[model samples]
Target: MTDDTLAEGKAADREKWKEKGVALRAFFYIFGTHVFAGFVWLLFYLGGHAQK
Candidate 1:
């Protein structure tokens, strides 16, 4: 293949990855929030039990 063709292919791949990256970032953000919330709940639960 020619250099121009290779460059075009690379550019296309980059665009595709950019789109996928946005979705992946959003998924991580949501997953992290849930994990953090669960951790907080666990701490609270342990604290309450310890008091008793």
Candidate 2:
């Protein structure tokens, strides 16, 4: 294949991997935040009840 064609192919593959990485990072970030927040809220809710 020509140099330009090969370069384009490599670029396309790079973009595909980058998109996948971004999506995976976003998923972990959001999931972790929600999980942590849920635990924190649960702690507060339980603590308030314990004081009563």
Candidate 3:
């Protein structure tokens, strides 16, 4: 109703849309998981036993 309350609500809405979990948390989570998975697959692909 008041300007002060409106400002606070706007600030909280902005913070809620920050998406810190998706951007920061997921950056490390997906990045680490994919990177490790890729490394493991690379080893298998380039292993001593080839599919010639």
1-52 per-residue lDDT for model 3 (tens digits): 9999999999998887787655898789989999999999999988857777
Task: Between candidates 2 and 3, name the one with more favorable lDDT.
Answer: 2
Better of 2 and 3 by TM-score: 2
Q: State, as a TM-score between 0 and 1, how close model 1 is to the true structure.
A: 0.64
Ranking by TM-score: 2, 1, 3
Candidate 3: which pairs clash? none
Candidate 2's displacement at residue 5, Å, is 0.4
Report the Cα lDDT for candidate 3: 0.88
Tell me the alpha-carbon RMSD of every candidate: 2.6, 1.1, 3.7
Alpha-carbon shift of residue 17 in model 3 (angstroms): 0.3
Which whole-number lDDT from 0 to 100 does residue 28 have in model 2?
A: 100
Model 3 misplacement above 4 A: 20-36, 39-43
lDDT tens per residue, model 1, 1-52: 9999999999999999999999999999999999999999999999989955
Q: Which stretches of candidate 2 lie over 4 Å from their true place?
A: none
How does each model score on lDDT?
0.98, 0.98, 0.88
Model 1 clash tally?
0
